[model samples]
Target: MTTETSPDEHQQQEIRLALSEIPSRLEALHFVTADARTPATVPNHQGRDEPTSIFNSYSPHLDNITNIALFHNEDQTPMPSPDEIIISQRGRRRFNNGSSPDSGSTPLRMPFQRTPTKVPLSTSMILRSSPRKRLTMGSTPPEPEPTVMPSPTKPRQRLWRQGLPPAKKLRMIEEGGKPIAQLNEETPLSLLLQGMSQQQLIRLIVGDLVAGDAETELRLRTRLPMPDINPMEEELLHAKRQIFRSLPTSRLCKKTDSSAYSRAALHLNEFKRLLTAHTKQLYDSANWDALLDYVTMAWPILRATPHWDSATHNVTRRQCFKLLACHCLAAVKNGGPLLGMVRLQATDKNLRDWARDFDDIQSCQSALSKAISKGRATL
Candidate 1:
């Protein structure tokens, strides 16, 4: 056979021999593919050092493999199969004794006792798990130390009585309508006002007037004398200017804009107040001639002022006409026949239209007619 062999046959034979050596060279191949971070060696089931295979390094299904070649040479001991490598949930290596064939051989101390994790067990679980203790005849079972649950903390008071101003504190500390500790809650308002100086009392009164106390305001205005009309006219002109200026620059879809409406309302209210104060002054001073003329002048201006029902227009109109009616009645009674003729003319010209809406004005109109008829009859 050697004499008959050709160069091609010998080359083919050598190729098959090289192919047979590949399985034996797998460890060197594994070593080359592995990084320098590979662990050098690990203990096998026989307690002997063995090299790790490439499969052991990267494979997640290690437990499934039955046979694996992890040795560089045939003489070296084989690495433990995947079954012998028991990994716990904590990733610690635990060796199984049954992995070794020799049953009589002593097992190595593998440090397999896992340290338990501590958790907060509830009181009921602990009580159920605990052993029952017997109480002796002479001793009463120790009463469980009462669980002192902490009381709920109170919310802090933002406005305690002590935090009040000194004057306010004194006012709150009254007893039985008498001054205790300077002032008491039970004390009469008159007594309190008496203690205040005239200037202080006047300041308080003025503040109430400015704050729009209607009753107090009415009483005060009834006694107030009319100041010069020149200043009042100037104020009216200024208020008209402010009202016109307060109109919004933008076009609105509604009848009025809110901010513009509020500003206009304030100005209208001021205008009405001024007119009312002056009218009341005329009536209070018994100047019937002046009041009649003032009403004629003021009415047209009030009627001309721009206002929605939401503003003060309707209220001002009603109030102004009522004052006019009262003036006319007084004139018919006290102003004699000459003033009666003047009032009669004023009512027919200026107020007849307003009489339809206002009951008071309508009554005044009827009264004026009756008086005129009565004067004619007496003549």
Candidate 2:
């Protein structure tokens, strides 16, 4: 027996059948519109034409129906009409030159390849291909080429002169007992005095005398030998020797005696005075040899003095002796004595204070002792 279907079941079966016909319906629509002359229609299940009223109920306008077909009802905008679609298809076919969609190939002819366009050559390219012409102003002349000077050629030596010495040779032989060439000949005094006023001539004469004196002094100093034992030096030496002998004895003996200390002080003063006077004489006379002897003999005596260990008084006493010896040597070597007592006093002060900051008094003392030893060795 056949079971009766419900109304809902019948509606469901109709929807399934409609869905199954959708693809075929779209295919038929495409085929009808593919040709503009064909009439557009909806076909029934028997492939017979159905009236437009059936589709019109779903969409009132043709544009709305096309939109629904193209966009599956997602978009509401109207689609192009059949004539516009036909015109667009015709343009695309013309551009592609009848190229097949399945052939997987592009059109051979490009619009840009119709005719080759000539591009203008750039300035650099033109310059590279051809020589550039310089533009000249009216009546202006071109710059002249620079003139090159020829290099100087050295004189060629003759075959015979190749091994010979130079033309201008330095003379090795001295002329016997003759005065050599002088650049300036000596002028006579009378001619020299001819153009002078009284004051000018006096000044000239004074200057000549002074120059002569200085020249004579220099000659004498240079030519004279160092004196050995002159009478005055001998006397001084004798006095120095006597003082040396007395000084040490007095120091040893005066350790406890007040009277002995007084006597010793007196002797010390005398010795210093004698030393100063002797040093001055030797320096003024330029008696370096005798000065050397005196310094060497007195150095030992000065070292043995009672004041040598006294911090406050020893500095002055040692400075005095050092100044005397240094000044004498300086005068002997430096060509002249120091100018003033002020400089002598300054020397004494410097000798006492020099290098005291670094506790380097021993270095200064050793240098002075070495100078005395050197002087003695020279003598």
Candidate 3:
């Protein structure tokens, strides 16, 4: 009977077991001589020693000797390398044909064809594969149709010149529809006077007739080149009062009259003369604010000039009519209910008559829009 080993002896045994794992080259001896029982040598035939290596450094027992590539599995089984293991597994899978010998079964080749993704094939010509040659919808083609770019066209015009079909008439209401009395050309010359600009005024009355913005109106009235229109000393005072009356108790033009009425009158007369005489020029050298020294005045004179008509025997009374028309328009400005801020006639009669007379008044309202539509004028 053996007794239990001491701890020191046990430790020694464990050390020996661990040392058995060391990897090393082995020098194996092979006896090439005849069997010892027969003889050491046969007379004509010599015995030779030869060695064939099956295990040496590769031995599992001696794995610990160098362990240049030491590896451990969970089960502690020795495996060569990750790449070699993968290769071995792949080989095993390829060898499996799903048939057993005893069953007398035929090895089955799978029906579905497997296609491996290939690296781009290298060749001198560099031609495409068969799939590339075929036109599949999802696949992009080599040469696409030249994307036809549509020609850029200009924007179309909205309003046509020929005009549109007539609109249906609308019925009017009773009390609300009761017509207001229409104003006429007698409305006021001054109505056109408000809101006009200096540039408009310097131009001829023919240009003024274009019916521009309100600035044009004011300029025509107040700054027009007519020095003769300056009121008398008392009259200028009255005119200022008139302007105040024209406005509601508020919003009157400030009195430009420096010395009450007389000085203001003189100032106005000079201003009128200055504007009317030298409109084509900018301004004459004069002390405009020198206390109403009336160097000139607008003498509201009327004269009928005679001109021979080459076409007709009758002398046309054109000047008379012109003067009358001008004076009448002037009257409207001087006379007032003065409703349309300075002197705009808002009455239906005045509007319609103006539209008829000018042939341009109504057209002007639509004119700016039409010009924009046609690309004639810029926004």
Off by over 4 Å in 1: 1-234, 249-259, 309-340, 356-359, 374-379
Q: Write the per-residue lDDT of candidate 1 for residues 188-264, one digit (tens) a residue.
A: 87776767885776677788554677887888878866335666666667766776776666564332545556656
Model 1 TM-score, 2 decimals: 0.37
- In the range 1-379, model 2's lDDT, one tens digit per residue, is 9999999997777567666766766676544332233235765664345322334355456445454454543334346876665455444345443465754454333332222124242433322111122222122346789999887897786755667766776667566533322222576657656767867755754566445687765765577675554554455455545544544365355442444344455556666776777677677776555665555555545555554333544454566566555754454344322223333333334445443422333334444444444544555
Candidates sorted by lDDT, best first: 1, 2, 3
lDDT for model 1:
0.56
> Comparing candidate 1 with candidate 2, which one achieves the higher TM-score?
1
TM-score of each: 0.37, 0.26, 0.16
Q: Which RMSD does model 2 reach against the true structure?
A: 24.0
Q: By TM-score, rank the candidates, best first.
A: 1, 2, 3
Q: Count the backbone clashes (under 3 Å) in each candidate.
A: 2, 0, 25
Clashing pairs in 2: none
Model 3 Cα lDDT, one tens digit per residue, 270-347:
433433443212123222211112211211121111122332311222322232333333333332232222222222
Q: What C-alpha lDDT do the candidate models reach, one value each?
A: 0.56, 0.50, 0.35
**Model 2: residues with Cα > 4 Å off, grouped in runs:** 1-223, 227-258, 285-293, 304-320, 328-379
